[model samples]
Target: MSIKEKIMSDLKDAMKAKKTDELRVLRSLKAKILEKEISERKGGEASISDEQVIEVLMKAAKQRKESIDQFEQGGRDDLVDNEKQELAIIESYLPEMMDDDEIRSEVQKQIEQMGASSMADMGKVMGVMMSKLKGKAEGGDVSRIVKEELSK
Candidate 1:
């Protein structure tokens, strides 16, 4: 099943199982997906694709992570715990992200493929790498690895 369909199915299951926290997260995700679909249609597009759904999920996950970070920095353990729970739920649907080693290796390969050397080519390397690693790796990690590799 598509990601959207899978989420919907899980939502129903969560509801049936009386998983209040999981149900709340699933409902919010469903609403976000529907909102994205409506916005796409209004833009003269047909509907949001699976890729778009992933994109939305990633954004939500990122937001939750940011909130967790800020909450922790502010010593708000209560809020941090809540954001962590939400982030865990959001991550249940995202594709497995590459670890640091994988990200570094991938960045090295891209740099070699592009024949990039020095910081001047950072833009060229980043543009292609971001598209190649989209949804699979975080942008910050990719950039850091690229910079480390190129500075060699």
Candidate 2:
């Protein structure tokens, strides 16, 4: 099944199981997906693909992580715990992220493949790297590794 279908199926399961937290997150995700679909339709585009669903999921996860960090920094343990739970729910659908070592290796491979040398080629290297790494890794981590590799 597609990501959106899987999410919808899981939403029903969560509802049946009386999983309040999971249900809340799933509902929010569905709403976001619908919003994106409507926006795309306005732009004269067709329905969204699984890749677009993943993009929405990633954005939601990023927002939750930021909320968690801010709550922790402000000494709001109560809010932090809530945000962490939501973040966990949001991440359940995401692919596993690459570790630093894995990301660095991939960056190095791209740099060689693209024949990119020095900081001047950073943008070209980054474009290829991000498209390849997409949902498997965070952009910040990929960019950092690319910059470090290019500097070498």
Candidate 3:
């Protein structure tokens, strides 16, 4: 099933399971998606492509990550826990995450392939990495690791 369809299915399951938090997050996600699609359709019959949908999902996950960090920093454990649960639900729409070893190896390969010798070559490395990792890895995380590797 498509990601949109999967979200609807999961939403039903969450409702059935009496998972209020999960249901809330899923409903918000569906709203965002439908909003985008409606906006996209304003000009014609164009609907959001799967890639755009993934971008929406990534944006949601990133926002939740920021919220989690801020909640932790501010000593709001309750908010942090809520953000964690929301993030978990958001991530269910994304593909499996890449671990450190995989990210490092992929960054290395991209750096070498792009002949990125120093921080000056950072943009090129990022271009390759972003295209390869896309929704699976956070861009900030990739950039930090690439900078560390190049500085070595």
Candidate 4:
């Protein structure tokens, strides 16, 4: 099933199981997806593609991560806990991200392929790496790895 369909199915299951936290997260996700669909609508019905859905999910997950960090920094343990729970739920729908080692290796490969030797080539390298990695890796991680590899 598509990611959107899976979310809908899981939303139903969460409702049936009386999972309050899961239900809240799923409902929020559904709302975000619907909002995205509406914004993209031009004339007829504009359904979001699986890739677009993933983009939405990734953005939501990123937001949750930022919230968790800010809450922790502000010493709001209760809010931090809540954000962590929400982050976990959001992450459940995302594809597995590349580990640091994998990201490092991929960055190295891309640098070699593009003959990127110095920091001046950072932008060119980043553009290719980001497009290649897409949803599989986070931009910050990829950029860090690329910088380390290029500086070597």
Candidate 5:
């Protein structure tokens, strides 16, 4: 099944199981996907690609992570816990992220392939890496690794 279909199926299951937290997250995700579909509509039946669905999921996951961080910093343990639960639910649908070591190795390979020798080549390297990595890795992590490798 497509990611959107999987999410819809899981949403139904969550409802049947009386899983309030999961239901809430799934409902929110469905809304976001619908909104994306509407925005991309070109006059006929509106639909989104699986890649677009993943983009929406990634954005929602990032928002949850940011909320968790802010809530922890504010000493709001209850809110932090709630956000963490939501994050976990959202992440379950996302592709597995590359670990730091995997990301590091990929960055190194890209740097060498692009002949990126110093900080001056940082932008060129980042553009290539971000497109290559896309949803598999976060931008900040790739940037930091690229900077470290180029500075050496």
Candidate 6:
């Protein structure tokens, strides 16, 4: 099943199970999709591709992560907990994230393939790496690690 169908199926299951938190998160995702679709329609309509949906999901996950960090910093434990739960729900629809080792190895591979040497070569390497690792790795994380590796 496509990601969209999988999400819809899970939403129905969450509803049947009375998983209020899960249902709420899923509804928010649906709303995000609808909002994107409506915005695109105002431009004369466009089909929502799976890639666009995945991008929305990724954005939601990133937002939750930031919110969690801010909540913790502000000492709002309850808000942090809710953001964590929402993040968990958002992650369920995303592709499995790469571990440190995997991301490092992938970054190294791209760096080598692109013949990157000094830090100045970062843009070239990053451009290729981002496309290859899209949705699989966080861009900021990859950039940080790449800079460290290249500076060596």
Per-residue C-alpha lDDT of model 6 across residues 56-107, encoded as one tens digit per residue = 8999999999999999999999999999999998998898889878999998
Runs off by more than 4 Å, candidate 1: 42-45
| TM-score: the better of candidates 3 and 4 | 4
Candidate 2 segments exceeding 4 Å error: 42-45
lDDT (Cα atoms) of all candidates against the true structure: 0.90, 0.91, 0.88, 0.91, 0.92, 0.89
* Worst ten in a row by lDDT for model 2: 42-51
Which of the predicted structures, 5 or 6, would earn the higher TM-score when compared with the native?
5
Candidate 2 lDDT over 1-152, as tens digits, reads 89899999999999999999899999999999999999889657668898889899999999998898899899999999999899888888887889999999888888888888899999998888889988989998898888889888
- Write model 1 residue lDDT over 1-152, tens digit each, in one string: 88999999999999999999999999999999998888788557666788899999998998998999999999999999989999999998999999999988888888888889899999999999889888898888889988888899
Q: Sort every candidate by TM-score, greatest first.
A: 5, 4, 1, 2, 6, 3
Clashing pairs in 4: none
lDDT of candidate 4 over 1-152, digit per residue (tens): 88999999999999999999999999999999999999999988999988789889989989988998898889999998988898898888888999999999888888888888999999999999888888888888998888889899
How far off is residue 2 in model 3, in Å? 0.8
TM-score versus the correct structure, for each prediction: 0.93, 0.92, 0.89, 0.95, 0.95, 0.90
Q: For residues 23-139, could you state the per-residue lDDT of candidate 5 as single tens digits?
A: 999999999999999999998888998888988999998899899889989999999999999999999998999988998899899888988898999999999998988889888
lDDT for model 4, on a 0 to 1 scale?
0.91
Poorest 10 consecutive residues of model 3 by lDDT? Answer: 42-51
The reply for model 5, stretches above 4 Å from the true place, is none
| Residue pairs of candidate 2 with colliding backbone atoms | none
Best by TM-score: 5
